[model samples]
Target: MMRIRHDQRSNEIPTPAVSFQPESVQMAVMKEKLTDQEAVVAIGQQDVRVRFVDGVPSDRSFMVRLVKQEGGTWVAQAVPLSSIGRFVPASLDDGIDLWLSARGIRLTEKEKEAVRRFWETEGGSIKQKQETVAALTAKQLEVTETHLRLAHEALHGPPLGDLLAPLLTKTEEPEETDEAKGVPVREQTERWEGSRAYAAASELVLPPAETRTFVMTAVTEKMRQLVHDFRVWQRDMARQLEQFSHAVAQQATERATPLVESLIHSLDRMLLNGDWLLFTDMKTETKLLEAGAKLAEAKRGLAEGKMDEAAKTVREVKALLESLRFQPSEQKVMRFFLESDERQGMKPHEQLSRILKQASQAARDNALSARGVVESLRRLGFFHEQEAARALLSGERLPPAENVKAMLLSWVEEGTAPAQAERVLMNLTGQQLLNKFTADSHTQTMLYQWPLSLHGEMATVHVHVNARSGNGQLDWQNCRLYFLLDTNQGKVGISLQAIERQLSVTVETESEKLAAVLQSYASTVKDHLEQIGYRVQRLVFQPMDTEDEERAATDRIKTENETSQWEWTI
Candidate 1:
C-alpha cells in the first residue's frame, strides 16, 4: 500500500480537504496547523492530486490517465483503475467508489436497485398516469358510440349524429355508477360477504359430486398446482407493488432510495464544516428529497387500479421509519427486544430481531430482557460499578443475589464490564438489586458555598475531578470528574437551578503579590436542560458532538476573543 507522506508535519502546517468528484478524484496534501498563507499556498498548488473519481465497486476496469498534453494545462481522462499515491501507488478503492458516487456514478446492481427503489417510493406525484388511463377509456367509449350510430344511420333514416346522441351525451348514469350505493350500507356489506362465501364454497366449502359428474376435463393435480403458482405470483406482485407505489410503472421506482441516503449522508458531512457548509448541504438535501418524492409519485402512478400493494409498502416503510428517529447507544433498547436468549451470550449483529422479539412486551411489563444485559452494560462504559449494577438487574438465577452482590460490585469497581462478561459466570437466581444499596466503580464529591469568614485559615473550594481508575490504569482514573455539593443545604439547590443558565462570579486572586490581582470572567450558556424542577441529578457531563475539523477551524477564527475565566468557585 502506497502512503502519502510529507517531510513536514501536517500538524505543523494545515489540513487538506478530503472530498469527492467525478472522473478523477483529487488527492490533496495539506499542513495541519498552517499559517493562513501556507494554507492558501498548499491549496493553490496541486500539492497532491489523485484522479479517477468514481468510487463504486465493479468488474469494469474504469480508470483515469492524466497527461500534461504538450500545453501547460494538465488534462485528465478516465482509464482503467490503477495504483496511485506516494512512493508505491496505492489503490484507494473505497475512495475511488466514493468519488464516483460523489460524481453521480454507481456500481453493483443491488446498489443501483436500492438507489432506484428509494427514489421512486420517495418521489413526487404519480397521479397523471391514472388520469391518462381514464381519458383513454373515455375516448374509446366515444369511438364505439360513433361507430354504432353510423351503423344505425346506414340501416335506418335518422341522421348519424342524432342516432348516436344517446351514447354521446354527458348525462350522469345513476343506475350504472351508484347501483352498489343504492343498497343500504349493511345490505351492501352482507351482499359482498355472501358473494365471497359462495366463491369460497365453489373451491372448498361446496360438496363434490364424484358419482354424478357429467364431464371431467381438468386434472385435480394441475388445478392444485395452478392455485399454488397463482398464490406465489400474487404474493410476489404484492411485494413488488408494495415496494413501489406504481405497481404497473416499470423503471421509475428503481431510481430513488440510494439518492436519498447518499445525499443525506453527504449533507451531514458538509454541515460539520461550518455555516457555509450547512447552507450548501441543506440545498442538496432539499434537492435529493424532492427527487425522491418524484420517484415515489411515479411508482404510485403504476400501483393504482384497485391494487393495494403500494399503499401497504408505504405504510410499512412509514412504520419502520419511526424506529429510525431514536438512535440508541445500545442495541438492547427498552423499546425493542433481542432474539438471543437473555440467559446466554450474544454477538451484536446476531443478537435479536427488533420486530420479532418480545422486547415490546417485556417493556410493557418493565422486564427489559436483552442478551444478558452485558452488551448494553459495556456500551454504557460504566466501568465495573454500572456493569455490576446491571448484572444484578439482569435477573439470572445466579447464587443468592444478596450474597453475590459483592461479586458484581467487584466488576463495577474495576470498570471491567466487558471483562466481567467473560470471567465470571454467576447463576442468575442469587444476584439482584437491593433497593437502598447500589455499587459504584468510582466516587466523586462536590463542595459548594465556602464561608467568607474562613478566608485563609480554612478556605473551601468546589472542584470536579475523576480520581478512580477501573481499568487499573492511573491515567484512566483522571478521565472523569464532578461535584457532590451541598446535598443537605438549601441555597445550593437554588444556585444549581439558576447557575445552570450562566454563572456570574467576581474573584480577586493574587498573582506576583500573594494578595493581589486575580481574574474574573463573566459567562453565560444557552438551554442545557429545559426539564426544570428535577433536582440536580449528577450533572452527567456527557455531551455528544460529531468531529468536524473544518468547522472547528472556522469556529477558532470566530471566537478568538472568548478566553477562559478564573474563578475560586470550582
Candidate 2:
C-alpha cells in the first residue's frame, strides 16, 4: 500500500510516495510489461490526491516516470507528454525579420544572414525582445501622432498654398470682353460689379453697413488694449529708470535725466493723441531694451563705487534713447522684415556644411562638455548637432535615428520654439514614412529635413543618405547622398554617389537660369570632391520639371541598383 500527500495551500498532488515491492516481483512485472503500465487518474480543480489500485480504467491518466530512490524503493512522479518533444530555442532573428517586413522593410539574403549571425552572437533574451518591440511600437505611435497633428493643422489653419500662391509664378488669364459676354461694355462692367456685391452680401447675414461697424468696433478695442499695455510698460520703465538714476553718481543722473524726460514726453503725447504708439517698431523695442541693459550696467557700476564707469554707461544709454527718438518709418521696418533674399549666396546644404565644419573646429578647440557642445551647436544653428549632443547627455545607448527623435521629443517638453519643434516633428514623421516605403536593409539610409536660415528666409533642405555595408560596418566609399530644396530660382535636386572613392554628381533644377549657374560651378564642385579624396568621375547638369521629379528619382534609383552590386533604395 502506498500513501499520496496533497498540498494544503495549492490543492495540488504532491510527488507520489515511493512504493516498495520485492525485487523478484518487480523484475517479473517489468519483464511481463516492457513499458511502464499506466494507471487511471482523476484530478478535480480543488482536489489533488490520486488513488492507485489494481487496474481501474478512467478517462484521464498520469504518465509516470519511475526512478529508484534510496535503498530499493522506486518513486513515481507525473510527467507531461507535451514536454517530451525536442527543445528548440525561440528565433529572435526571425521575429525581427518578420517585424521589419511588416513595416515594409525588405532585407537582402546577405543582410538576413548577417542579422541572423548578429542575433546569434548577441543572444536575444525575452526581456530584450520585449524592450525592442516596445521601443519600435512607441516610435510608430509617435510618427502616427505627428502625422495626425499635421493633418489637423492643415485642416484647421490657413492653407499654406494660399499663402504661397502670390509668390508663385501665375499664368496669364485671357482678358474678359463685353463681346465675349454678348453685352455692352458699360452694362457688362455694371453686371460684374453687381455680381461681386451679391456674392459679398451672400457671405454674411448682416448688411454691409453693420459688418463695417462691427469691424470698426473690434479695431478700436484692439488699439485701446495695445495703448493701455504700452502705457503700463512705459510707466514701469520710467519709474525704474528714475530709481536707478537716483542711486547713481551726479554725471550718470544727468545723462539719465534726458531718457526720463523723453519717456515722460512720449507718455504725455500718448495721453493727448496716441501719436507715440505709431513709433512702436521692433527697432524702438530693441533700443529700449539696450537702454534698460545700460541702466542695469550703470547701477551695478554705482554699487561697486565706479563713478567713471557708471557715468560712461549712462552716456551710452542716453545715446540709445536719442537713436530711439529718430526711429525709422513703419513702412521701412515692415519692408526690412519682409526681405527674404539669400544674402550669403549659399545653398542650405552649403551653409549647414560650413556651420558643421566651424562647430567641429570649435568643439575640438574648446574641448566642450556635452551640454556646452549642445549650446554651441544651437548658437551656430546646427539643430541636428544640438540634438545629437543632447542624446549623448541623456545616457541612453540609443541608435542615431532614435537618438534624434528622442531629443526632439525632449525639446518639445523643454518648451523650445514651437515652430522649430513642430518642423522637426513633421520632418521625423516624413522620414519614417519614406523609410517605410523605400527601405533597403543592405544599405542603411537616413533622412534629415534641416531648416536653415538663408539670410532672412527659412528654407527646408531634405537630405537623404544611403550607405552600403558588407561586414556590418559603414562603407563611406560606397555611399549616395541627395539634397533637395525649393529656392527662389526653382526646385533644386543634387545627387552625389560614391563607389569606391569614385564620385558621380548630378544637379537638376527646374529653372534654366539656375541650371546654367550650377553648371558654371561644376568644376568647383568637382575640385571640392577631389580634394576630399574622391575622384570626381561625373558632373552633369540636367533640366527636370517639377512633375517629372518623382519619376526621375525612381529612375535614378533603378539605374543605381543596376550599376551597383548593393541595392541603394532610400
Candidate 3:
C-alpha cells in the first residue's frame, strides 16, 4: 500500500515516471551497474528490488533508494530514514523507500549512517565496521537504482517524452461538462470502458462493412459481461482451493499420518520404474538397521518364554518403526521358532538365528576385518611393523619395511623389545622434523609454534618455512632442535612449519661441500612433499645457532613466513 509523492498534491499517486534521458539530472546516472550482473532498467511507479552483496551468506533485510552515480553505476548511500518513501506493495522494491522514510532513514547513505548507529552497541567488537557497511551499502544501492529506474520507465513515458511521445501526447481524457460532472465516477468509467485497449483489440476482428451501431453496442455489452464473469469465477475458484487445501492438511494431521509416509509410498514405485541405484542414503540405512535390531530383541525375549510381554512390546515397536520411511536392507534377519515337542514350542533364541550364533562366527568376521586392515597397511607401508608384530605373536602376516624400520628404531632406544601392550605406547611420536619453520599468517609475531617428530638423524618435514633473525646464540635443545646431523658440515637443523604440516630446512654448515649436499638432500625432500601432494610454497635460508638471531626467528617466524618470497597468496 505504498504511495510515492513527487509533489504536494497526492491522488493515490501511481507509478513513478522513469527516464534514462537527462532532465536537469543525468538520467543515465540514475541507472545501476551490477559488478557481476546485468543492469535492469525500469521506469515510473515500478518497484525495484536490488539485492546488495553483503559478502556474508545470510544478509540482513531493508529498503533504500536506488541512486546512480556520475559513472552511471549504482551506489547505496543510506538516505535519512525520515526522507524515505514507500513503493507499491506487490513490488520487490515496493514500500522499501517508504519503510526507510517512515523510520526516518535514508538508504543512499546507509553505510555511513548505519556504522555510526551500530558503534553504540555494547561490546560490538567490530573493528572495521564502517568499511564493511560501506561495501555492502554500495552493492545494495546499485541494485536498488536499477530497479527504481525500471519502475520509473513503466509509469512515465521515457520522461523526455522521447520514443512513442506522439501517442502519449495525442491521447486525452474526455472533457466533463458542467451537467456531466454530476454523474458518478463508476458510471463515467463504464461509459468510456469500450474505448479501452480490450475493446479496440476486439473491434479489429469485425468486418468493417457489416459493422453497425446496434451490432457494435451488442458486441460491447457481451464482451464486458464475459470479462466480468471470468474475473468473478477466478476469485471464487481461488477461495475454494485455499479452503480445500487447508482442510486436507488438517485432516491428515488428525489421522496421525505423516508426509513422509506419502513420500515413502512413492519411493517403491519410483524405484521400480525409475532410477534405483542412486537411492542409497545413510540416514535411511541407519533407520532400517535400528528397526531390525528392535525386532531381533523382541524375538529373543519371546523365545525366552515371555509371550505376553514380548507381544505387547513388539507390537508397539513394530508399528512405530514402520511409521518411519526407510530404505530396505539387502538382507533381513528372520527368526523362526521351532516346535520341540507336542507339548511345547521353543522360542527364536532357543532355535538360534545367525546373529545369535555370532560367537561361532566372530573369528571369521574378525579375520576378514583384519585382512582389510592388512591391505590398507600394505598400501601405506608404514604399518609393516604392526603386521610383523602380529605375525610373530599370532602367526598372521609379514610387516612392511617402513614399519619394521620404525620398530627397530624403537627397540634400539628402549634397549629391549617392549611388552606387546607397551610396544604400541612407546612408538607414539608427534609431528617430527628439525628445521626453521613458519607460523600461520593469522598469528601474532611475538610467539609461534612448529610441529615436528624426529628419529635419529632423519627429519621428516611436512611444511614450508623461512628463517631470519641474522645472528645470535640459541638453545637448540629447549627449542626442540633435535635430529641434528653434524658431519664435517657445521649443523643442519630441521623443523615442521606450523601453518602446513611440512618440513623446513636450516643448514648451518660452514663447509661449501656440505651446504651443497644439504641442498641436494632438500631437493629430494621437496620431491617427496610434491609426491605426497603438499604445497611447497617457500624454501628459505637464515642464520641459526646465534642466540639473538635464533630468538628473533622464534618470535617473528609467523610474520616472516607469511611475507616470504616463496609464498604465494593463493
Candidate 1 regions exceeding 4 Å error are 1-23, 30-360, 369-570
The count of backbone overlaps in candidate 1 is 76
Candidate 1 per-residue C-alpha lDDT over 1-570 given as tens digits, one digit per residue, 9 for 90 to 100 = 999787665556655644323233333333232332112112123332322223222322233333322232233443433343221212334443434443334346544343334224322222222122222222232222222222222222222122212221232212422532342322212222111212211222112355112111122232334344434533443354344444223444344343323332332332222112111112222332333333343334434532344344344433332222111111122111111122134322122221112211222222222221222222212223444465679975444221122334444567643332321222111011101111243422211111111211211122222233332222211232221112212101111212212222222222213212111111111111221111222221111112222222111111111122322232
TM-score of each: 0.15, 0.31, 0.18
lDDT by residue for model 2 (266-362), tens:
4333432343333233335445544544554555565576767876775666555544332223332222121211112444333333433323332
Model 3 C-alpha lDDT per residue in residues 147-190, reported as the tens digit of each score: 22222222211211122112122223235456534433222123
Highest-TM-score candidate: 2
Query: All models: lDDT?
Result: 0.27, 0.43, 0.32
Model 2 / residue 63 / CA error / Å: 51
* Separate clash counts for every candidate: 76, 0, 72
- The TM-score of candidate 2 is 0.31
**Candidate 3 wrong stretches, greater than 4 Å:** 1-483, 496-513, 520-532, 546-570
- Prediction RMSDs, each to the true structure: 35.2, 24.3, 41.5
